[model samples]
Target: MVWRPTLPTKDNNVRLEVRKTYKLYIGGAFPRSESGRSYVVNDAKGKFLANASQASRKDARDAVVAARKAFGGWSGKTAYNRGQVLYRIAEVMEGRHEQFTLEVAASEGLSASKARAVVDASIDRWVWYAGWADKLAQVVGSSNPVAGPYFDFSLPEATGVVAVLAPQDSSLLGLTSVIAPAIVSGNTVVAVSSYERPLPAVTLGEMMATSDLPGGVVNLLTGSASEIGPWLASHLDVNAIDLCGISDAEEARELEALAAENLKRVRRPAAEDWSESPGMSRLTQYLELKTVWHPIGV
Candidate 1:
């Protein structure tokens, strides 16, 4: 075997952008599951940059279990406490705003200004949802009038465990768009981030871990959507699913059927112009109703 150039004879002055590698941020510390599996994350040019875990079905199950276990306290948190915690997430997002802009630009091929807008939209989403934590009842619901002498009032409640298929195409905007709404309404989530752009998701997890979020409120898993989506849909414990950015109608329908097995609540695929101004439609999907009535004698 003959070797050629081992040293730099000429300074080509080549400066290539290197991708920052990451591991699955699970249960707080970044542990690569017992399976010890990883898959490649590529750049916009389709060049392999770093590895993301191929979180197995078992990983999905475990994440569901963690979310379930934490649901009691998280769902039980007072609206004020919940709002405080959710607001803190926006604070962390503010600190990492530039980091998200840079990562989104590289992976999603967005220009600097557009990527910055995307990051801003994501941060603002958190704050928007934060405002709803305590006030959704006043906005989307009201007391009902019965024919009898009784009182009837209806309001939203958390729907146990929600499995979210975070939007696939837009990295920061889509991921935050799905996740913020789910958690802000007091639902726990096991979200699969945009496969092509998971770095921002992992970074978001780190943000939550350090923020005031209680353990296991939001779990982020990175892997094949096709491989993992069905398991979450069919899992008996998963109370609902939101397939916001599925690429095909057939696959979306198939997942919907699986969710129907347990009568899981599903938010239909909508073509809402997420690029437009953000609003309360996302806030309503994750809500459940808790109606109370009392007999009144006049």
Candidate 2:
């Protein structure tokens, strides 16, 4: 039998590199696709990066189950506790900054400098959203002035499970932008990562597990949006859908229709600079406002 020689580097020494396989982040564990299917992931230069799980309808269903089971505990936590947990995510992300920069560079075709900028912004975004958790209600809710002798007030509540389609173009930043807002308000998320660039998202999921985020607080799926988008939109248990990553009008239209079946709160995709200040718009969208009145005669 003929033996094969090891590949040599420029220095003439044999070299081997171990590549990482990307997988679905559900219930705080990385699992292969339930269908046992995977798709090749290529970098900006069209080089093979890794194999990403091709999540199936059953995977989406499982994610919904995880998110629903997590919602009660997550939303029940004190706002201050939630804020601390969100901040821990930022801390973990900070420790993994180099990994994110490299992945963003390969995925987006950005130079090292530009990729670093995006990574920095993404981390800062978590901090921004983390602060909002404890303060959003105070900023958005208000006491109403009524004509009668009654005290009227309005307050916000966390919507149930939210399904997120993360932005496809700006992988890291857009992913962080959409996710932080939804979960900051105490809504658990089942997010679909950037279809074209899912490495950073998978790594972020790993970070989430170690950062004090409970299992199922945030579940991530990587695969064809077209396949999972409709399933998520139509899932009866999902209370909302953020269509931020769906670029095609027809696709968004179809998903919107599916979401309408349950009157789900939908955030339709639109052109915008994700790096800009996100403001409170995203936070408000996932929130449910309840107004109440009490007789003042007592």
Candidate 3:
């Protein structure tokens, strides 16, 4: 049974519970969105225990500002330092199993056990991505050759601000897939969550906010995907778009076209295979082909 600390009576229960409200976590601090908006998060029983931000375009801009502010610090850190920070996130996720299972159950409308599974899987996903931070450079990257090389090489660099359309289903894993690739390769992302599955996204945000991830590395926004998906596609600030969860070919095409305006890296949706495939492939989708050149001297 979920623990209820002392069954609040008809008296102070009202006062004590009133002090609690789920708030959006931004920039490593839990603060009400500057827009000051909230929407209800309903449980499977259709009861509301908390509210989530109706994150606005203003919120998006604020997130971009935060990401920009944090970028130098995060991206400047040594790759191993970045790896350690990313791994710390998984450590934080480890200690919050009960809370994750309960909140995920409420948000996704799944059975408690199933919610537990998703939460556990999500934590493992972070560990998977964490392990990739320092290693992706070595694995997906390679030295370049020239006619007379003095030593030339290129490494994958961040694609700048990326916009993510989180999965329509499998909320947690889907978001993890999208965000992991972007951040692991050094890109920053502003994610539009699955409208129905936004709860876990914010929960993941809560973990990141507290887990030593520089703020804005992964900004989570929950809203009309159809509405914002295209907007983000054409957003001047966005350098790449990952349309992984968009199953509709027409919509995907439309979004891809929008991304073309700025030549943003576009990753089209792929066939779903839960069996086994290297998830590191997410890093390759947005990786840029930068080439360094040097002339051989006599």
Candidate 4:
């Protein structure tokens, strides 16, 4: 007798999953690339996952405009208030813990438990940066001694519209490490997510939208770093750039040359252990020191 495949039954059913269209996060809203372009994103196993917006040079320019517009307000907020907002972001991320773990696992090809650990560490890293928002002034700023009857002081201030390149390998954790430090110090940012593993960064943009953070304080673009990096590095309005995600040495050198035209603060890429302690370097890199002199009586 020949065996045949079983027929569908009422108790068994197949449902189609709703796939998400990953778009660019700009000015606290999700918008498709103005270029009307998109690229296919794949899972670690090389299976089709979804489509991500391929941001263009125009998108990079728009992101810079948004960051510049939001700088004054975000930097003006009290340090304690900024700390509270950062902490709130951690709370929201905790609520979406499972989703982040799933995305990280697919993006990095890690086991479920390891992804969970990374997610947990990302949340903790946010909290750690939150705690520093209020304390950074005390730690980095100082009262200077002068021979005259005047008081001299040096204080750290936000560097204004910073552009960041999120790390390629450690998507979530490295992304968190770079972003938290910059924003905790009140600098607005336009960040380019990893080209290969961008899902976690898109998820992060969602959390930022729900949290107490203001629009345009952090703009995320999902596309090629090579395409976006040069524009941001050379943009006249941009104040600084973190080149942590640029893997090509030649490309990095070229970008640095462009940044020099505007005298932009360039943070060169280096081998980083994302899981280890992130000291004050990232926080201080995007900050400017302001010195003041005042009469002792005044």
Candidate 5:
């Protein structure tokens, strides 16, 4: 006797895990690449993961526009208010702990415990930078005694739109370390995520969107930085470029030259461990010293 195969019904319940499709985070929205192209992501062992939007020159341009638009309101916000928003981001990120741990483990070929440590470090990094929001100026600025009867003060100010090439090695921790410093000091960012492992960055962007942070304050793109970095380095509206993602001396030098056209502040990549305490250097890197003079005999 032949037996017939039957499809599963309510009597035989089955569930399927839903997979996620990653997209670029621009202006607080997840948008497909303007070029309408995408590349597949894989685990450390070459297993399929998902497709990530492959950002192009046009996408870079759009991110710059978004960053520029956000500069005014973000920079204008009180330092205390900015600190609150940053703390909110840490809260949201904490709620997504399991998700980040799983992704980081797969992308970086680490065990669960190791990945959790990275995730924890990233969240704490945000908190550390948040505390500096209200105190950065005090630590970085000073009053000077001028020869004349005038008071002179030098204060640290946001340098406007900054483009960051996030470190590719430590996808989560390094990315957090690079991003928090720039935005914590009131500058908005357009960052390039890791070319091979970008899922964690997209998840961070999601947390930022819901954390009461304003749109475009931190735009993230997932693609080849080599393809997009030149446009960002040369962008006239961008006031600075963080070259932490670049390791090659020749490439870093070339981007530095491009940034010189507009005299953009360029921070080259340093060989350091992201898991260690970052100190105050990152806070000072993207800041500009603005000196003001006031009459003493008023």
Candidate 6:
């Protein structure tokens, strides 16, 4: 009798895990790179992870357009309303705590406990910024005492569109620190996540998509920051840029030069401790101070 190989039984079959497809979060939607490109991401031990989209110049331009389009509505919302929306995002993020913890651990090469702590801090940071959304005007704006018989007041208004290069080292915490402050003041953002550790940022984007935050208010792109940074800096419509993630001095200067074409409010990169108290500087950086003088007897 001829020996025949038996088909594997159902009980002996190995189950395959369902992997996630990481894509760009733009205009409140996930899209594959228009360039049809992706790059491999590996773990700290050089283990195979997942592939992330490689954003192109076109993608950067599209993100700016989305941010510009959303700016009016987001900036028009009452401060109280923006606060509520930001708080809602924190709420949504809390539900995905486990996922964030895992991603943070994998992306940053931290132990589970440490990753949990980082995730916790990231969530709290978001809430902290949310609390300041409505109160910024009182702290930053002022009632001027003028010699003339007129009521003089100063108010903080949102800058149209901001481009952010999220910190490459402190993925989640640093990413949160830069993003929350910008959006809390009604400035829409086009942020580039860290090149090597972008998983946590992508997870954050997923949470934002399901939250009360308006689409385009915070668009996240994952790819080569060096490739996309120049396009964003030079874009005529971008109002401001945070260079906190650019590590090279020469490259930062080059980007700054490009940004000067539009006089974009440039936030030069500085060494930051993400765990430390984040002052009001970032919140006020992208705001425009508008003063109004009302005649005493009009």
Q: Which candidate model has the greater lDDT, 1 or 2?
A: 2
Count of clashing pairs, candidate 6:
0
TM-score, structure 6 vs. true: 0.95
In the order shown, what is each candidate's alpha-carbon RMSD?
5.1, 3.5, 5.0, 4.8, 3.3, 3.3
Tell me how candidate 1 scores on lDDT.
Answer: 0.83
Distance (Å) between predicted and true CA of 35, model 6? 0.7
User: Could you tell me how far off, in angstroms, the CA of residue 255 lies in candidate 6 after the best superposition?
Assistant: 0.5
lDDT of 1 by residue, 1-298 (tens): 8986555346764455676557665555566754788878887888765788877788888889888988899989988789889889999989998888888888898899998998888888788778888897788778999889889888888988999888888777888888878887788999888888888888898888999998788988887778889999999999999987687889999999999999999977777666776677778877788888888996
Query: Where is model 1 poorest over a 10-residue stretch in terms of lDDT?
Result: 5-14
Q: State every prediction's TM-score relative to the real structure.
A: 0.89, 0.93, 0.85, 0.95, 0.95, 0.95
Candidate 1 residue runs with Cα over 4 Å from true position:
1-21
lDDT of 6 by residue, 21-102 (tens): 8999999999999999999988777787899998999999999999999999999999999999988988988899999998
Task: Write candidate 4's Cα lDDT for 1-298 as tens digits.
Answer: 9998666577765455778999999999999999999999887898887899999999999999999999999999999999999999999999999999999999999999999999999999999999999999999999999988889999999999999999999999999999999999999999999999999999999989999999999999999999999999999999999999998899999999999998999999999999999998999998999999989864
Which stretches in model 3 have alpha-carbon errors above 4 Å?
1-15, 18-20, 31-36, 44-49, 245-247, 271-278, 295-297
Q: Cα lDDT of model 6 overall?
A: 0.93
lDDT at position 239, candidate 2: 99
Best candidate (score: lDDT): 4
TM-score of 2: 0.93
Could you give me the TM-score of model 1 versus the true structure? 0.89
Q: Which pairs of residues collide in candidate 2?
A: none
Distance (Å) between predicted and true CA of 187, model 3?
A: 1.2
Candidate 3, which ten residues in sequence have the lowest lDDT sum?
Answer: 14-23
What lDDT tens digits, residue by residue, belong to model 2 across residues 86-197?
Answer: 9999999999999999999999999999999999999999999999988988998999999999999998889999999999989899999999999988899999999889
Say what the RMSD of model 3 is: 5.0
| lDDT for each candidate structure | 0.83, 0.93, 0.73, 0.95, 0.93, 0.93
